[model samples]
Target: MQALPKTRTDGRLPLYARLRDQLASRIANGEWSPGDMIPSENRLAEEYGVALATMRMALKQLVDEGLLERRRGTGTFVKQPAFRADLFRFFHVHDVEDPDGPVIPESRILSRQEVDLPPEVKRAFGDDAGGRCLKLERVRLWAGDPLLFEEIYLRLPDFDGLMSLDPKEMGPLLYPVFLQKFGILISSATDELSFGTATQASAKYLELPANSPVAVIERIARNPVGRIIEYRRVHGRPERFRYRVNLGEQHT
Candidate 1:
C-alpha cells in the first residue's frame, strides 16, 4: 500500500474530497496511465486509513467527472479522451473509385522552425507560454492528392527536440509522437470549424484557388494535467468537410 499524502492541513475539505484530489493528482502527473486499473477501493481505504464508504465516494466523484471508468467485471481504469477521434468523425478522405472505402491521409512536413508565437497562441498557453515555439507547416494527402494544409505550434523547451526530427522518419500523426518521444499525452482538445477564404499559403499547399472558400479548423490541445501542448490550424476544400456530435438521451 502506498502511503497517501495528507490533504492540506486546513481540514476544511472533507476526507473523501481530499482523497479524490490526491488520486487525481497521481493520474494527472502520469503516475497512473490511462488504461491502468487503480488500486481496489478496499485497498485504497486500507492504505489511506479511511472508511470503505469514503473510498467509494472518492472513486465515484472521479467516475462522474469522466476521468475514470468503472467496468462491471474489469475494475476501474483511467479514462483518456482523444480529441483527435473527432477528426475522423468530422472528416474522411473518400476514394473516388470506391467512395465508401476507408482512407488515411499521409502527412508531409514541408518546413520546421522556432518562432515567436502569435497572440492567440500565447493566450492559449497562458503562463506556460515561452519566448518561442516550434512550428511546422505540413500538408496531408490522400491517394496522392493534396487535401489539407496545416500549421502546428508547440511550446518551447518542452518540445525542443521536435524541430530537429526528420520529416522522412515521421508518421502520419503528431499526437502519438508527442506521447512516445516527449512524454506528453494529449488528452483533450477544443476545436472550432468555419468557412474561410484560402490564404496564399493554403492555396499553394492545398492547390486551391486563392480566396476560395475553405473549411478552417482551429484546435487547442492539452495534456492530461491540462497544460496547453499544441495550437494547430488547418485548411481544406469545403467539399470534404463534415462534423457530428453525440448527446445523452433526448428529454420528452
Candidate 2:
C-alpha cells in the first residue's frame, strides 16, 4: 500500500479530521475500490506515527461517513458509492434521472401489519387506526445492495386494497402508488434531519458495524385538504449520501 500524504502543521483542524480528509481524498482518487481491505488500525497507527486511539478516531469518522465498512471478524473495506440528492427539490428515488444511479432497488419486506395506531401516528393521521392502517417495514437497495431501511404508515381508508398490490412492482417509490390508488396528492411536506448511530436492525441491513453513524430523515407528506397522508422515517448511509441545500439571499 502507498503511504498516506503527510499532514500540514499550519492548519487548525483536529488531527483526526485531517487524517479523515486525507483518507477520503485518497479514496476519491481511486486508490481504494469497493470491497478492498484497508490497513488495520495498528498498521495505520504505525504508518501515521500516531497513537492507536487517534487512528481509531480517524477510521470511525470515515465509517460514519459511509466511506468505509466493517465486517465482523474481518477488516474494513471501501463501500459502494451513493447518489447525491438535493434537499431543496421534491424527489422520488424511482424518478431520479441519473442513469448511472440505482436502477433497480432491492427491497425486503420485514413486516406488514394492521393494528391500533400509536399516539404519534394518530396525531399525524388525525384518525386513529380505529378502523385499520397498513404498516410496512422495508429495506431499499441500490444495484442489488441494501442502502436504506424505512417504516411507512398509511391509513386503511386510503388504501383499502393495498395488500393486493405486488411488492415487486412498488420498487423504491411509494408515493406514486398512493396517488394512483387513492388520489392522495402530496401538496407539500415537512422534513427534519438529524444524526444518529445505527440500531441493531439498521446495522444488519446496511451490513455495517454496530453504532456506526447514520443520517436520519423524518418526513410528513400532506394532501390538498391538509390531511397528513404519509409519514415516513428513513435511515441513510452517511458516507455514501449527502444532503444538499440551496440557500437564497435575503433582501437588503
Candidate 3:
C-alpha cells in the first residue's frame, strides 16, 4: 500500500479527507497537470489499500472543488481553466489609430536565474515554499519604445529548467510557454495596481529618469488547483497605462 506522508497530512482527519488532501497536494506539486487523466478509482483504491468507495468519495470531493473532472466514459482529468488565454490581456499594447486592436509587444529577457526569494515574496508563497526560486527580468517594447519593465518570480522545482530556455523563442506571451514547457496552467491571477516612483533599474529599462512616477502592477498567478505559481511586479510608463472596466448586469 502506498502510504500518505504522515508529516504532511493531518492524522486526525477522516481517511477520505486525508486522501483528498493528498491528491490535492499532488496536483499542487505538479504531479498531474491540466488535462492529464488520473488513475481509475479501483486502481487508486488498490494502490492506496483503501476501499473503492473511499477512493470515489475522495475523487468526488476534488471534482466538486473544480480541481478534477470525470470524462463521460474515459477517466478523470485535471480541470483546465477557460480564462487562461485572457490572463495577460491587461499587459497587451494597443495601436493608437486602432484602439480596439491589441498588439503584442516585443519581449526582451534581460536575466533569468535561481535566487533567494525576498521575505515578503516568500511569505506570499506560503511557509512550505523553499528559500529560493526562479527570477526573471524582462522588458516589453512597442514600436521600439519601452512600455514596461517586469520582475517575475516563480516557484522552484515546479519551474525547474526554465532558465535553460532561450528567451528569443518565448516571444511576448509567457503563459503559453509555461503550459507547453512546464505543464503548468495559470488559471487565475489577481493584479493590484498602484503608482510608484521608478527605481534606477526600472528607469533604465523604461527610458525614464530615476524617481519618475510610474504605474505599478503586482500580480499573483495560480494554477487550476489554486496553488500559487508565479508572482510578478511590473512598472509601466504612466502615460501608456490605461484601465477600463464595465459594470452592471449583463443581458443576452
Candidate 4:
C-alpha cells in the first residue's frame, strides 16, 4: 500500500488540515470504500511522525465533514458521501410542512425535556437565555420505511404548547404547527450538508447494513425578525436523496 504523506510545516495551514485534504482526495479517488476501517490515530501519527493531537485534529476535521465515523468501541471507518445541497435557499424535509408533500415521515419522540442550553445551541438561539427550549428527536420514514433520524431543538416561546402535543398529532408539518399555535413565521434557514456513516442506532432504525454510509445535515432556521427558532440535525441514506441548487449571475 502507498504510505501516507509526511507532515508539512509551511504554516499557511495546519498540518492536520493538510492530512485531512489528502485523505479526502484519496477517498474521492475510490481508495477507500464504505465500511472500510481507517488507520488508527496512533498509526497516522507515527506515519506522519507528528504528535497524537495533530493526528486527532485531522481526524476530527474529517468526522465533522462526515467523511469518517468514530464508534465508541470500534475504530474510525469510512463514511458514505452525500449529495451537496445549495445554501442559497431554504429546504425542509418533504412532509414537515408542505401539504402537497408525502406523509410518509413518522416520529418516535425519544425524549422531551427542558435543559440549560449548551453553549453552542444557546449562541445559535440568540439572546434568550431566560427562555427555555424543547428538544425533540424522531426517526423519519419514506413510504413507511425508515429514511432518516432527526433531532430538533426549538425555542420554547415560539412553540408554547410543544410539550402537550402527542407525537402522532404533530402532523406532517412542524412549521405550520408553530405558526398556528404561536404566530411564528419561519422566514429563512441555513444548512450545512456532508457525508457521514450511520450510528449503530441510526443504522438499526434505517435498517441499513452495519457501517453503511449516510448523509448528515445540520440546519438552523430563523424567523423574519432574525431570531433563530429551530436547530436540527438529520442523518439519512445517502443513496436515496440529492440536494439540488440553482445559482444566479453575480454583478460585476
lDDT of each: 0.80, 0.68, 0.82, 0.68
lDDT (10s digit) by residue, model 4, range 1-252: 335453334447667777776666555444665568988888878877778998899889878866688988889987643312222122334544675643344546666777667666777876664556788877765557766777788886656578887777767557656654565545457778888888887788778988888888888976532457788878787667666767798788
- State TM-scores per candidate: 0.78, 0.54, 0.69, 0.52
* lDDT string, candidate 2, 1-252, tens digits: 435464444477788877776776656444665558998999988887878898899899878866788989999987654333323122234435775554446567887777667666777786444545788888877656667777777877777677777777665566656655554545456778887988888888878899999877777876532457777777777766655568899787
Return the top candidate by TM-score.
Answer: 1
- Model 1 regions more than 4 Å off: 1-22, 45-67, 79-85, 95-103, 243-252
Return the TM-score for candidate 2, rounded to 2 decimals: 0.54
Please report how far candidate 1 places residue 150 from its true position, in Å: 1.1
Candidate 3, residue 247: the lDDT equals 86
Runs in model 3 with CA error above 4 Å? 1-32, 36-92, 95-103, 249-252
Q: Which residue pairs overlap in candidate 4's backbone?
A: 96-173
Tell me the lDDT of model 1 at 220.
Answer: 93
lDDT of 2: 0.68
Better of 3 and 4 by lDDT: 3
**Residue 89 shift from truth in candidate 2, angstroms:** 8.0
